[model samples]
Target chain A: MSQGEPGIELDTSLGYMLKAAASALHSAMEAVLSPLGMTITHYSCLELLAQRPGLSNSELARGAFVTRQSMNVLLQSLERQGLVIRPARAPVGRALPTELTDLGRRQLEVASAAVRRVEQNMLADLDTDEQDQMRRLLRTCITSITEPPASTT
Target chain B: MSQGEPGIELDTSLGYMLKAAASALHSAMEAVLSPLGMTITHYSCLELLAQRPGLSNSELARGAFVTRQSMNVLLQSLERQGLVIRPARAPVGRALPTELTDLGRRQLEVASAAVRRVEQNMLADLDTDEQDQMRRLLRTCITSITEPPASTT
Candidate 1:
């Protein structure tokens, strides 16, 4: 159906709107990042590693909202590019700790600028207040879903 | 950086927040839909087809925010499941038209209820006003990016 059709079949719930906006924004991001030979998923992993030097695979996967298997595949790809390095082993555990290499750091610098440009272009219509409100609402939603319930005691 | 770090390298932009929220919501959706043997991508395609019976592959891809190649793979899978039927030729053009089968409509009915539960859980915290505002802002963002500029006479 077209935009103004009566009784459109799609449910205009908050989740549906969020999914549509995210999908559109993701398409824009992929277009922007494609020239740099990075998918948004790759960039997200690298960005998280840049900020946190020695995150375990599970930790990174959790932060990136990807499954551990998917994260492992992404890590392997980054490693193959020599942009990320995994240390031999963690001091306290058997887990492998991943850190961005110097090349990866520089790449992040470039990717960050590209991402910022895309973000600005996407949000050009909203004033600062509206933007802030949107962010707060999203954060609240995320926290409510992710946090565990308090004990009844 | 840890949460207390003075300068954590977070993007904190509207696009970033939107992406993060969408990612989390999608993961939740996938978890709920997996037992029913459906990815969100597949469910989306089925949903659109159920609503509009004769959508072309390109039109479905555009509505679902996926590449034509990806859409082709998904359609093949759905057709194999006996949920979708693709005509060899369309009245308008050579491009094929696809519609949901009887099984597809029933699948969608079941999946829609599960999806609604996940969505309700996600939005359980927000009051009605917050939910409305969230939907309005997200719709505005989607429209701003997707809509072409007005023609200058």
Candidate 2:
């Protein structure tokens, strides 16, 4: 369909492509991780906490690119599963720092393998170079989109 | 951290990058489309139905990459909103076809503009060639990941 005029019709826009690829990968990951009683969001939260122990709730929310409210809900779910523990002492103006417990660590280990297997299948078609390129480009785009705008005088 | 090495290291993996980009875009699109009272899932269903006017329920599910069960739920919501209509007669073995109403078409027009604006802002940093390359690479990867494997001897 034309936008009020005739054109080549770029149906494969970057947004469409990104959404399609992500959706496909996400669906596959969900299928693989669901039996473990986790969603991609759940696995991501564990992955973040595993990598950065003692991150405040807000910090974790920022890293996860979700609203603080949403992150809190996820934290509650994780805490219930014994995958994470929040400290008693609260930060000055933020929620208390949270860390993974031994049980959480073990769960992370299992989840990591499941996730890596899914990633391998997803990237199987691409050789090393293409995979690297894909990662680099996506990283650049993510950074660009997430960055604050520069001052325009 | 090396493989099998533990404790809080940057993931810096392709899966992480892909997931982050997708999450960011999803959040951005959600914010933009929220004023219209539509989720990305809703917008996607409407778009597919718009392009293919007479799609059956299962076909719509496949086109939208959602399970039939989920599609049924979404269809119910859309039906409640009066944006979609389904015929009463059930064909031989197939469910009745679904199509968008006039209100759905108008809503889609508005949503399309909002989507395009957000997409433009998201891709502002990349040049045309880079955009093309990103789309091509993502398309290739998705096709590879979603395709059925060839039979092995």
Candidate 3:
């Protein structure tokens, strides 16, 4: 019945499946994170800061897949909560580099382990080779969409 | 320097790559759909209705991977815009069965095609076998996470 239209076949569409997988992972992460009073974006910000310290607000937003304004709001909340801190003035440029407080790292240590367990559970059924294959396919798809159109490139 | 923690390695983590792929596809879809005045969730709701004419608000919420409250808000807006219709009273159960208007179908035709293009672009580099592999891999991951943990199952 749907053959006449160009609508995506939800059962077979790679995009839909990708979304479902991502959404499942997100919900699982949230399940683990929420008990500790963290949202995915909030946990993401702290994790990013842990791995790459002194990242600016804009960079953190990009890394967290959020807008700069939303990241700024989160930063302010985190600051008030003493989870993160930014200097009163930019030492080098207009961007204020953000850092995690001692409390932040302690919180992140717990949250990170929970998140890792969720990821591990998600991959529990798959073997190493299959995990690698999934990773490759996902990376290929990301490159296809993120890179410039073929005509321009 | 960072060997002590369980924090996910952003570069090698399958879950992180899954998120990146989904986010890229989401951005690509938004780029196309926004020009036609649609958000992904907005488009998802219409598309779900087109494919399943009698889906209830809760069912639509499940299909679209959004909370019931968010789906309720979207439905109200869609109803006000004359894109969808529900009976003044429930026809059968407490759930209100929703169906799209002719206008909604017409709008969906255009947005569906645009979304299809975005999906195609994302899969441009993959062969049929690779696409099938990705579908299998994604389905497996979804199942692993969504099914009861092995102890309970």
Candidate with top TM-score is 3
In the range A58-128, model 1's lDDT, one tens digit per residue, is: 88888777889999999998999999999765767777889889898888777777776666666668888
Residue B103 lDDT in candidate 3:
97
- Number of colliding residue pairs in model 3: 0
What residue pairs clash in candidate 2, if any at all? A51-B8
Clashing pairs in 1: none
Candidate 3 TM-score versus the reference = 0.92
Task: Please tell me how candidate 1 rates in CAPRI terms.
Answer: acceptable
Q: lDDT of model 1 at residue A28?
A: 71
Error of 1 at B94 (Å): 2.2
Would you list the rank order by lDDT, best first?
Answer: 3, 1, 2
Docking level for model 3? medium
Q: Encode model 2's per-residue lDDT on A66-90: one tens digit a residue.
A: 7888888999888988889997668
What value does the TM-score of chain B take for model 3? 0.91
> Which parts of model 3 have CA positions greater than 4 angstroms off?
A1-5, A150-153, B1-8, B150-153
Candidate 1 positional error at B47, Å: 1.4
* Per-residue accuracy of model 2 over B85-139 as CA lDDT, tens digit each: 9987875555778889999899998998887776777777788887887877888
User: Interface root mean square deviation of every model, in Å?
Assistant: 3.8, 4.8, 3.7
